[model samples]
Target: MSEKATRNFIDAYEETRAALPGVGGWLARRRESALDSFRETGLPHRRLEDWKYTDLRQTLEKAAFAPAPAHEGAVVLPDRRSASAFAAIDRHVLIFVNGRYRVDLSQAARLPKGVELHALADVVHEQWAKDLVERRFDDTRQAENIVDLNTALMSDGACLRIRKGVKLDKPLHLLFFSADPGASHTRNLILLENEAEATILETHVGEVASFADVVTDVAIGDGARLNHVKLQDEASDAVHLATLRARLSADAKLSSFTLTLGCGVSRSQSFVLFSGEGAEANIDGAYALRNKQHADQFCVMDHAVPACTSHTLFKGVLDGESEGVFQGKVIVRPHAQKSDGRQMTHALLLSRDAAMNAKPELEIYADDVQCAHGSTVGELSKEAIFYLRSRGIPEAEARRLLVLAFLDEALDLTPHDLARDALKLLVSEWFGEAVL
Candidate 1:
């Protein structure tokens, strides 16, 4: 049955291969190989240990999405505040409507001297792009295999490179809006050269019943720093799948945070490898779901080198009949002496019907390393809510305040100050709407 659903994607690829980027080049061959891999593995199902919570194969089979049609004309962005969370911030914006880059709607002019930014098609021939795309992480094969589907069908995305010792003056914002009702695959490649620094802001929002598949590959060179913040708030009927793979070199730093608010079914995966010592990686997120929305968060932190540090924390609130899942693991290799890794996940269930599943694990082989993991799932404190109500606060408002406070710990970890405030505001608005 899963193979039958996989045929749809294979057929789409065969039909669109000629029109995709890097025709008759290495990327074309890469795409063909990726398609073959996808053909063999099919979509990730619940049978897979890593995908036990979210059955992507079953979900995609039910949706039966075809290729998203090419979207032209002006795109009216979603009217909700979550759709434009970063509008007030000063940054370079790139907009993609229906999975195609809209140069007319993007504002990436006058980038820094050493910064290189182009559409996925424009840089497919570059060695750096190829290296980022072809690089593999061995620890999370099952979780990362789904990336082959994105590689085979990826239509367009942002390709960014920051040269050594360069610092981007402002953030680079990638906005993906699904204006049509179908499936769209996107791939983003980002490379930060040694000692370079940059920040990335990503937002995905749409109302169409669509399938949005996205893959991002990042390489942070020695002493480089990359900060990433992402927000996902698609339609209630939309299905979203996103994967991020990153490698940190010696003394490099990566801080990534995500806030999930919408989508009927969504799965987000992150794989980080510490290839060099003294590097640091911080992955954290907060999510709020209502209705029948279901979200799954999976992460793998590979401390392959010595003297590195990694941390992971995820906190979320579930209401209505919504469900949330978190699976995270931290690995410290035998030679990774002095490595420090920690992971924690906590959730608040606002309704009896709401459900949460969390699994946090640590694999440490280094005798000199410190590693810990924990998870907690519970409902809001009745005493606290009653105390607020007795103070003349409306029950709805009281619940909102407590939820905000509960999520603040994770939201506070957002690397960027403005983006942090923006996420907090969006989460607050989402809770208000959920209650109403």
Candidate 2:
């Protein structure tokens, strides 16, 4: 089954290779190389240790999705709050429909000096973009091999470069909507030079039974900072796979948060590597799932240098027959002394049929490192609910309050104030609908 699905993808690549961006260039060669690797590995399945909880090969074999066609028309955004959570934020908006950039709908004119923003095809020839695309996080090869599929078939994405000591005046929003029911692959490249700063907001919302594969590569230079927030709320029958690979230089800081509210089966993978001393990476997220939704969050934090700090926290609530998985690891290499790393995941089950699987591990090679990892899965406190109900609060309201407080810890970690508030509101609204 896996081999057949793999052949289907390979055939699609062969048919679309001519129309894909960066033909007859370095990118073209890179695409062919990635395709070869993908063909060798095929699709990940339950037999793989890293993918034991999610059988992507079986799912794709059953779905048999074709390539999403280029959509040409005005996009009708979903009616969910998450679809427009960042509408009020002052930012440059770039819209992509069916894996194709829509220049007519985008608004990113007059970007600040030293800031270069372009579509994937426009920047694929640049050295910085090539470096980011070619970079590899070998430590997590088992979990990252899926990225090869995106590298070979990626159609369009955002390319952002921030020069040294420069800061983006406002956030940059990348809005992707799946207008057709097929498949779309997107690869985003972000480069921040020394002392540079930027905030990026990403929203994925649609109501089609589609396959959305996305990869984002980020490079943060010395003394630089990046604030990233993403919201994923797609159709209940959609398959969403996203991978993020980030490298941090000396004294750099990265704060990333993700909010997952929808999708039938979704897996989000993040790999962070500290290449220099004194770097920090804070990855946190909150999710709410109901019905038959299944979501997975996989993360790895590697401390290859000394005196770095890394922390990860994820909180979620599951109801009905939904399932959630959190697999995370923090690694401190030899000679990487004084590394402070922590990882934690907590889930609240609102229904008896709901399930949660968590595996948090810490591997320390240095004697002086301080690292710990933990996970907790439990149902809502009936005693607390009764206590609130005795005080005249409605039962539904009491349950909502408890779930909100449980998830607030992770949501508070969102670096942007406005984005944090918007996420909080969305979570609350989601709970209200679920209880109804």
Candidate 3:
């Protein structure tokens, strides 16, 4: 079954390669190479260490989704709060419905000077864009072959480039809505030059059982800074796989956080590399799940240069028969002295049937480096719940408060104040509907 799905994907690529963007150029050759890599390793399964918890091959075989159609005409955003979670925030917006950019739904008219924003197709011919797309970090390429599938079939995405010494006055929001029952592959590129600064917000919401495969590659120049926040609340029957790859230069900084609230099966992977001295990165996230939902978070931080710092924290709650997994690793190279990295994952089980799997590792070759990793999985303290109940608070209310407290520690890591509060409210609402 997995091989058939792989064959179908390869066939789709063959049929659409000529029509895809940047045909007859460097991108065309890149896509063909990506296809070759993907065909070699169909999908990541439990046999691979990085994919031990999430069997993507089996999951894709079960869904068996075809490529999504290019949706035309007007789109009615779903009335659910998840669809408009960031509507109140004033910012430049770009909308993608069913994987195609919707100009009518977007408002990116007056971008600041030195900020160049274009659709992926428009910038594929640019040298900088090609450099970003072609750059490779680790030799364990086959472990993340799903990214190759995205490269071969990516339809559309946003490209943001900030020149040196310029700062985006407002945040840029990318909202993706999956209205149909098919697969959509998207790739976003962000490049920040020296001393440039920007904040980006990403929201994903869908209405049907769809496959949302997205990859966001970011490059931060020396002394540049980027703050990114992502919110994922897709349909319960949807399959979501998102990968974020970021490279930081000397004195550069990156702060990224993700909040997951929905989807039946979802995996979020983040890879951060410190290529220059004195760089810093903070990666954090929180998630809440119920029913039979499954969510996995994978993060790897590489300290290849000296005097770099990286910190990661992920917290989640599982209810009903749900499951949660967190796999994180931090590596410090031999000559990368003064490299400081810390990683921790914590999960709260709200039901006896719920399960949590956590693996945190540290690989250090530098004697002067400070690296530590720890994971904790436990249920709500019954004593604390009883104490709250004894105070006359209702049982549900007590549980809600306790759960919120458990997740707040992680939410506090979000860099944006407004987005942080918005995510907290969404988590509260999710608990209200979850009935405990």
Candidate 4:
């Protein structure tokens, strides 16, 4: 069943892709091929194994396809609790909206002494850009539609790097805004050189029934470290599908925090591939769903080296017929002995209609490795509720508080304290004071 709306959008997109400047016949040909794939595949349906539980085609068919009109130059972050530590973090920041870079709101002139940030559009034509892409993103073709399409049509995104052995005092912020009812697709490729270390915050926000499909590819060189926080709080009518892929070299370390809040149908997929010995990765997140909404979070950790470790803990709270999906996979290759990987997912259903679906998977080829995964779907504990009510709290309030407490372990894993608090307050406001 093809939706005429999506077809109409594809038509408009064809025209827009044709009219874009500076791209040559080869690039345009690639865009046409990608658009053709999109036309055939549309959005992945539930029948597809990877998309078995997500019927994204239904939501995407209802979206508008025209790129959003340009807006005035001012940075507007979604409101958070006043005391968010992120507000004071002195970080290099890039801002984008509706698939275009926001120059005014973005920081360009003054970054750390050795740091360099360039918009992808500005550098794609340069010889260095080709060299960088060849070396850093050679594995991009292995990804899905949103990723390949972003590569084919992407004109602007961020390219960031810190010099070897540099430790910066501030964080790097990548902020995305949908702002209108048009579908937005963008790509970002980031790299960290040897011995460099940094923290980055990536966030997306918007209103209206729209779509934001994005991909961020990161490559960490030897001895480098990256702390990434992904915050997704788009409009309830938005379909937000994104991938954050990271590849680490020897002795590299990566820590990631993913927040699944806002949006009607949103999913964040993370692929962390540890390619070097002694590399480390940590994944953590918290999500809350309400009002018939749905949020899907999935991650894969590939252990391809010896003496590596990865840890994952994701928790969710569902209410009002909202649903949560969590799928985690840990793969340890045969020779990758001494690998320690652990995964856990827990969900709390606040209503009979609210539901959770979780699958924790472990595929181990090395018998000497220690890898384990566990998931549980359960209702609020009556004993905990009774204990809270005994202290004079209302029954509903007690349940809400208990659920919030269960989610704290995931949120506390973030290095940014303020973002965690802001998310807590957001859940409170959305679910009422009972949840705080």
TM-score of each: 0.99, 0.99, 0.98, 0.89
Per-residue lDDT of model 3, residues 1-436, tens digit only: 3687798789878877776888898898889999998888788879888888888788888888888888887788777787787878888999998887898889999899999999899999888899888877793364458778888898889999999999999999999999889988999999999999999999999879999999988999999999999999998899999989999999999999999988989999989999999999999999999999999999899999999999999999999999999998899888999999999999999999999999999988899988899999998888999999999999989999999999999999988888888888888888989868
TM-score result, candidate 3: 0.98
RMSD of each: 1.0, 0.9, 1.1, 3.1
Model 1 per-residue lDDT at 258: 97
Please give the CA lDDT of all the candidate structures: 0.93, 0.93, 0.90, 0.74
Worst 10 residues of 2 by lDDT: 137-146
| Candidate 3 residue-pair clash tally | 0
Worst 10 residues of 3 by lDDT: 139-148
Residue 38 in model 4: lDDT: 62
Error of 1 at 20 (Å): 0.4
> Which sections of candidate 3 miss by over 4 Å?
139-143
Clashes of 4: 0
What does candidate 2 score on TM?
0.99
